[model samples]
Target: MSSAPSIPSAPSTHPAPPAGWQATFSEAVRLQSENRWEQALTLLLPLAEQMPHEASVQNLTAVLLAQHGRLAEAVVLWQRLLAADPGNVALVANLGRACWMLERKQQALEYFSLAVQLQPQDPLALLNMGAIHQGEGRFEEALAWYERVFAVDPHHVQALFNSAQLHADAGRFTRAHELYRRVLAIDSKHVIAQAQLIFTQHYLEHPSPAQLSALARRLGAQCAAQSPVFSNWLVSFEPERPLRIGLLSADLHDHPVGYFIEGLLAHSAGKEVTWIAYANNEKRTALTERIAPAFSAWNEVFRWSDDQLAARIRSDRIDILLDLSGMGSGHRLGVLARRPAPVQVNWLGYFGTTGLPGVQAVIADPRCVPEPEEHWFSERVWRLPSTRYCFTPPKNAPEVAELPALRQGALTFGCFQTLAKINPRVIAAWARIAQRAPQARWRIRCGVKSSEEDRRSLAQRLVQAGIAADRFKVEAPLERQRYLASYGEIDVALDTFPYPGGTTSAEALWMGVPTLTLSTPGMLGRQGEQIMGAAGMAENWICFDEDAYVDRAVALAQRSAWLALAEQRRAMREQVAGSALFDNARFSRDWHELVRNIWRDACEQVISRSSQGISGPKP
Candidate 1:
């Protein structure tokens, strides 16, 4: 993402201070050390006026203000300090941090560069610089900066975590695994790192399905032991009554999760369920605005602590709480572990096991998780009958255009997933596909607009594999409507392996562009395959290996009746629009039944335990 638009500079406007500044400054420092930020700021504000020209005083005051969310004021003070002490590394670095907090990324990068130049070994400077490059889609540069930080401080957790993420993003699973191991060795209790290590295994050829189940059982046992259990009397699920349901997630805005959920919400409204949304995103978008009213109640709990959120859930007396975000950041796994509701399940927003004992099930579809694979989860594998997702196509999508190859004389194969999913192996596979269809051009649309550097780098890699530079096209990120329209430019969509496109595939199909996906043994790689299969296009698009993939693409490109098939795709939309894949009402009703059954089963267990004279500890 680019830097945010510039904001007007904050003016220096502090009044002159009283005397005896030294004693007050010391008191402020003491309060700051004690973590009493408001009290510290009260002392430091007045002291700043007495010593406006002193760098130390101004730095400390600015730090306090920044810590207290007074970013504009802190930026003013930090800039004033930097103007006087241009060579001071701390002042320069702090100014950069304040600017970054204000989303003034251009200014932040400049100051951070100055700080790094002043002290090459500074870890904070290195980390911030790496972050800036990473945000700009400059992966190699980000990796170099992270490596430098690792060299300076080998045990730097953020550096290790971020480096591992980059590797994972680039489809270097083995290297990513090694880095995550290093992180776990240093801090075993780091929950995100632990979760990531397990998640990344899905990309490997032989992901041990049992590993997630074992991790779940172990984590669940720990949660059960340390946290007080609710007495049977405290938990209730009335099978014949309207259930109070709570959904928790950070992706309830304009995202894939939102599209998948909109249908369910519309179907569930005023039904036998009273749904509440505990949203973790602070910002709202057009989609969020559209979906917000579907919930009977909406709570913006982005600022609430896990404990606070959990207590709120219990207070609401929610019968069931479905975690839309499983191991994702901002997840309230802590709250789930505390057992705020009688039933909790992991759904939509995440794949794989959450490893939380309080979570009773992971919702899936019969096609995605076979009955034999049920043992892969710690929670019960509850399969929805048709498909897990009920896709809602974007409202502003342009009408499907005729096959581009009909006019252009050569077929164009493309994918619009994030560039991170395009690893060396994926690139090599695409090279082979292009080799098979010599006349076909390759198109890639990344999440970020492709820079010239990105195009050059990609061209270098493809040319090395015998693909011509002129045969490749890299489109920049576009607005939603135009992006959907851009799909009309390609004859076929190529799915990324191990981390294949989920929403992108849906959009492609909606635009009458069939996606060719290479299915792996693991769940992550099978999403596109499942979506296409549910849409009844498995034979036309799903492949089992590189040869099959190349064969499919080449066959499609060479067909004399290619345009007939392409024109027939216009009907493909009509086929899926009301089918199981796009039927929200059916999916919603199925989900409702699934949840009710789980809750009733839990209630039955509790009743059975009570009859057997069993009692658990009370919270």
Candidate 2:
């Protein structure tokens, strides 16, 4: 809803307005009704000056500025008024919110803390504090503040959704799903909650791929129904002009998606394709700096709503829009649902189908979406000549040490995975491995930092499954260099099923510790397969079932087989370093071909439709 400045009667102590004040205020109101916000503010500023002591006029103006998307201006105005009356709780809370919109977290926390000090039960203040903690990865503190908000306002939807997200990130899918459903029961149309429920399904040991697709498709249909798909694109049809492609994602900073696409963005920007970045993330890391110069245009669009971003893409005349974050954090699939471009492709960021019919295609490789598994996707599969991802080797990774088993005299294994991936089924499988190879020592690194209680609970579960505390060790998270160095202690890396490793699996191969992966029927299951295939370990490492997974784990530990892997470990790093997975130049050439082919396809379809006299978007 559009809003404008509103003026209410001041107290008796304020000076009475001049005789023409009534008529002038009415004129401003009329201007506001006509959507002339600037004219309305112009008329009201003079009236506000007539009573300097009454702060209401300036406050209203600040709100108007905020509503008009001038968050920094709103913060400045709020600060100026706050100097006069520092005790104003509403003004303090407003400053916190404005600062938050500007992505100034520490400043927002300072103001929100003051607001909470003044009004102990303020839900907004409490919620903002929780959000700051959540973003910083201080999970327990975030949940505590959220609990306070619930105590004050039990049905606070935002708090519920965020708290649920904390659970989901910590791998407590059951609790997260419960909270998502609770939010849904209150407001059934919440798009992200719907997406979150489906995201949790990716981790299930035996999830119904069809059911997951049906649910995601329902979400796609709902968003499409409400979106305004652009049909009147002003793009030229001439064969040889440079094509503008927009990459939309929030993970362009210190993440797996960052590592995968940064090289491509750099290598592809030089040629006929003009790669534009719509970075949906707010935080900028070292990786962001490395990749920023690669793009022809970089837009910090974390704050752009779907309508705002869609309009911007249309205005930029982007020929193709690529979704980089997929169903993961900070995805702008809602904008894709709007059909903002002539061709939108779902690629590197997500696995499987987005379920949005508006998305014309998904970038695939022979490994990810084999011909038999093509039914899993909703969009047409545009298979690439090489791997799905082009990896950028971590600069800090240590050289592979002599295979850990040779010195230890028994097989040693490690899995550095999130708690979300280490479910009961995985634990059971590991327990079976422990029974088969009694001398096999295993190490688990729990990256889940939500609470100490959860960590202890995981350790207890391992013991309950008959793995002695002496035979296994559980460790906390470490920094990148140290984390990579730890791989030297393990002869083999154990991969989780269904929701198998993506980045960790690739890293395992890079460190010469081949991961034993269980590939199931879905894209989530195929991540390990893709990484292994790209790293040239397809036949020896990838397993199709639990029996095969167990067999491989056992077989690979035998004296002769273990020695072969140990020998391979010495050369594994350079082998993968030279493969299609890490060849940026090769990946770029493939991408150039991809962009040209998809554009040609889009142009041919448009021309065919024109010949048929068909008009409007492709629906």
Top lDDT prediction, candidate number: 2
TM-score of decoy 2: 0.88
Q: Model 1: residues >4 Å from true position, as ranges? A: 1-99, 106-122, 136-141, 204-235, 296-304, 329-332, 424-432, 449-456, 545-547, 616-619
Model 2, C-alpha of 590: deviation from truth (Å): 1.9
The alpha-carbon lDDT assigned to residue 368 of candidate 2 equals 76
lDDT of each candidate versus the true structure: 0.78, 0.81
Q: lDDT tens string, model 2, 182-244?
A: 999998888888888887878766777778878878888887887777777768764467888
Model 2, residue 417: C-alpha shift (Å): 1.5
The collision pairs in model 1 are none
Window of ten residues with lowest summed lDDT in model 2: 1-10
lDDT of 1 at 473: 77
* Model 1 C-alpha lDDT per residue in residues 518-543, reported as the tens digit of each score: 88654565787789887878776888
RMSD of each: 5.5, 5.3
* TM-score of every candidate: 0.80, 0.88
